[model samples]
Structure formats: structure tokens, C-alpha cells
Target: MQLKQALASAVERLDAADVGSPRMNAEVLLLFVIGADRAYLYAHPERELTSEEAARYEEVLAQRATGMPSQYITGHQEFWGLDFVVSPAVLIPRPETEHLVEAVLELARGVQRPKLVDVGTGSGCIALALAHELPDAEVYAVDLSAEALEIARANAARLQLDKRVRFLQCNVLDPVWEKTPDVIPSEDFSPSRGTCCSEFRDFDFVVSNPPYVAFSEADKVQKSVREFEPTMAVFAGLHGIDVIVPLVEQAHLALKPGGWLALEMGYSMREEVVNLLSPTMWEDIRVVPDLQGIPRVVAARKQ
Candidate 1:
């Protein structure tokens, strides 16, 4: 079939499926199938697809019609201007999460060879991105799901950042300790914290884009997001701050005296997060908004 005609049909099908960004999705999938770029599509509007290419494009379109994310179909997503391999095993990296990386880079600017850790580092996007940008820094990525860690490891290797970041399959930063207990210790550590837990200490920063969607809010997400993406990477608990609440305490214990903790939080939970990082344990608390001025990132320095 001719390129223009095929794309027209694909768009109509996607629109009927109620897929968002139908035209753009159709064009991207077609381009992916034909091994061509958007400019080439315009220049060769009369181009005819080979039988195999036509079949493959149709298959992708059918998949999209079911609300499978295009990123999963293409096995890739772009974040911080870099293309990342993505799959159902890991959360597809979002553009908003780039702000997490930006906030980290900005805070770590003056720190030399900083020790950094990313909690719940699903695709290793935040950690790998930081390691790529800060070659001298020591980077650690932690996740609870082995499948997710595998994806993260694959991405690190694909980006030629394999040696730059360490991947650990554990619950958050708990693996960093010398002898991490089964349960997370109390927030108000006894100063003898390291004696019972990890000896790893003095992190320059602990960053994360943790799960912030509540179970009840799950239905509010797109069908693809709810059905395809890893659920633990999306939903936290009843309040969606299940992870964030603990993260604030963990980050404080994990960072150096003046180190920073940066997190990408839900826009509506800004005040709750701010309250979590009260003046006693945290200082220099800042909430960074994305392009739309939504409070997207909450950063604080350990006092």
C-alpha cells in the first residue's frame, strides 16, 4: 500500500480506538516500520511499502488500537534527550522525570565525585542519566523487582554506561547497608544506625521518581499505563505517598550532613511532601515546577 494511504487508514483506526495522538502515533509507527524518517515520509508521499513492511505496520497499529503504549510497541522511549529501551517489565521513562535528573545535576554541580543513589530505580533512567552526565560520580541504582533491574541493566549496557552504574535488586536503598535488617529501621536512628544496618554512608544525594499514584487513582491513568506498565512502578498505596513518606526519612539518614535529596513528586502532594521535610531535619527545601508550573520536584538538604 502507498505510504500516505496506509497512514490515513492507520489514523482512522487509532481514532476509532480513541487512542490519544492518533495522527502522531500513526506517523511514528509507520516511520518505524519503513525504516524512514518523518522528512522522508513527506518527500516520498507516494512511496509504496513492501508486503512485509505493510504487514508489520498493520500489526503495530492493531496493538496500539488496544491501548498498548507506543513506547512499548517500539521498545524505546526518550528521556533527557536520550533514547531508552523500554518494556512492560519497566516503567516507560516519562518526560517529566527528566526534571529529577536536572534537579540532581544542578544540586551536585559543586560536589566532587559525589556518591549518589536512586531509589526504586526501575529502568535505571535517573541513575544512568546522572552517571552519563557526571562521569566522575559514583552511582548506585536500587529496585525491588529483578525483572525491572534486568531492564535497567540492559539500558545501562546499551548506552555504554554499564561500568558507570551499579544495579542492586533490593527494596530501595536498604541494600546499601552492611547488614540491612528485614524491616527498615526507625527514622530516628540511635546513632548506632550503621551498627545494625548498612555501613554505606554519606551519600551526596539520594534521588527518586517513586510510585505516586494511589490504588484508587489507578483508574484515572490511561488504559496502557494501567494495563501494561508495571503496577508497583505506578501505584504506591492508599495515599500514593506510601513510598515518598518513607523516602524522606531514608534520604535524610542516607545523605551527608549537608547533602541533598531530590524527588519527583505528584503535583497535588507538594504540601504533604513539604510537611514531610520539616525544618528540623531538612533545610533549603525547594519545590521545582515543570514547564506548566506544576510543582513537580521537591528538593531538600539534610540539616
Candidate 2:
């Protein structure tokens, strides 16, 4: 079949399956199969698809028709202008999360050689992006699931940022508090560093795009997210603050005086998340809105 004919057929198939952005989905999947760019798709309308290419295009279109995200089918996604490898193990990085990165960059500008940790660092998008921007900063990424960590680590290596960030597998900040030999080498520590916990408490920033969707609101999520993405990276609990509550406490314990904590939240979580940061423990609390003017990121400084 010709390129234009296959694309038209795929778009029709996706639209019939009720897929959103059927044309875009068809174009992306087709481009992925042919290993070409959007310009090639339009310029080579008469180009014939090889037998293998046609079959592969059909396979991916079928996946999309079943509510599988195009990113998962292509095994890739772009964030902060950097391409990242994604799988079922990790949540596909969203564009809005870039606001959380911008928040940290703005606050960390004055700090020299800042230390930052990304909590629940799925795909290592925020951590790697920070490392890419703040060349002198020491960045660490932690996640509970080893599978997610594997994908995150691969993205780091692929981006040639493997040496820039440390990938740790543990529950939240637990690995940072423990005196693990593999986590923090002895030579990396300073004599003035206090207790085991204190040794890792001088982070200038803590950033996250954690799971903020409440279990009760699961039905409200997109079919692709609810069905394809990792569950731990989406739903928090009954109230959606289950992860953020401890995350705030951990950020407080992990950050140095005046260090900042930035997190990406749901559209309606501005008030609830702000309430989690106690006045005594937090100050300069600010909520950042996305391009849509919806409350998206909430950042605060440790008191």
C-alpha cells in the first residue's frame, strides 16, 4: 500500500475505535514504522511501504485502537527537548511537569553546586533535566519500583547523562537516610557532615511529579493513563495526598535551611496541597499554573 493510503486507513481505524487525535496518532505510528519524519510522510505520499513496514504499521495501529498510548507503542517520549525511553514500568512524562523543573531552576540559581533529589523519579525526566541544565549540581533520583528505576537508568545512559545522576531504588527518601555504601561513597562525605541522616540533609531542592490522582477520581482519568501507565505513578490514595503528605515531611527532613521543595499537582489540588505544608515548617509557599491557568505546581521553602 502507498503511504497516503495506509495513513488514511489507519486514521479511519483509530477514529472508529474512538481514539483521540486519530490523525496525529496515525501519523506518529506510521512515521515510527518507516523511520522517517513528518516531512517525509507528506512529501512521499506515493512511496510504497515494504511488506515488513506495512505489517508493523498495522500492529502499532491496532495497539493504539485498543487505548494503548502511542508513546508506549513507540517506546519513546520527549520532555524538556530531550527524548526519553519509556515502557509500561514508567509513567509517560507530561509537558506540564516541566513547570516543576522550571520552579527548581529558578530557585537554585543562587545556590553554588546545589544538591537536589527527585522523589519518585519515574523515567528520570526531572532529575536528568536538572542535571542537563545545572551542570555543577549533584543530582540523585529515587523510586520504589526496581522496574521503573531500570527504565529511568536506561534513559540516563541513553542521554549520555549516566554519570550526572545517581539512580537509587528505595521507598522515597529512605535510601538517602541510610548509610548505604553503594548509595553514598565514603570519600563523597565531608568531616563536618553530622549523623547518617544529616549527611544527606543538605539538599538545596527536592522536586517531584508524584502520583496525585485520587483513587476515587480514577474514572475521571483518561482511558490510556488509567489502563496503560503504571498504577503507583498515578493514583495516590482515597484523598490523593497519601504520597504528598509523607513527601512533604521527607522534603523537610532532607532539605537544608531555606531549601525549596517543588511538586506537580492535579488541577484541583492547589488548596489541599498548600494545607499540607505547615506554616511552622514551610514558608514562601507558591502555586504555579500551567498554560491553561490551572493550578499545577506547588513549591515551598523549608523554614
Q: What C-alpha lDDT do the candidate models reach, one value each? A: 0.86, 0.88
State candidate 2's TM-score. Answer: 0.93
Residue 61 in model 2: lDDT: 90
Q: Point out the worst 10-residue segment of candidate 1 by lDDT.
A: 182-191
- Residue 302 lDDT in candidate 1: 96
Candidate 1: list runs displaced more than 4 Å: 176-178, 181-199
Q: Judge candidate 1 against the unseen true structure and give its global Cα lDDT, from 0 to 1.
A: 0.86
Q: Per-residue lDDT tens digits of candidate 1, residues 83-149?
A: 7888898999988899889988998888899999898988889998899899999887877788988
Off by over 4 Å in 2: 176-199
Position 241, candidate 1: lDDT:
87
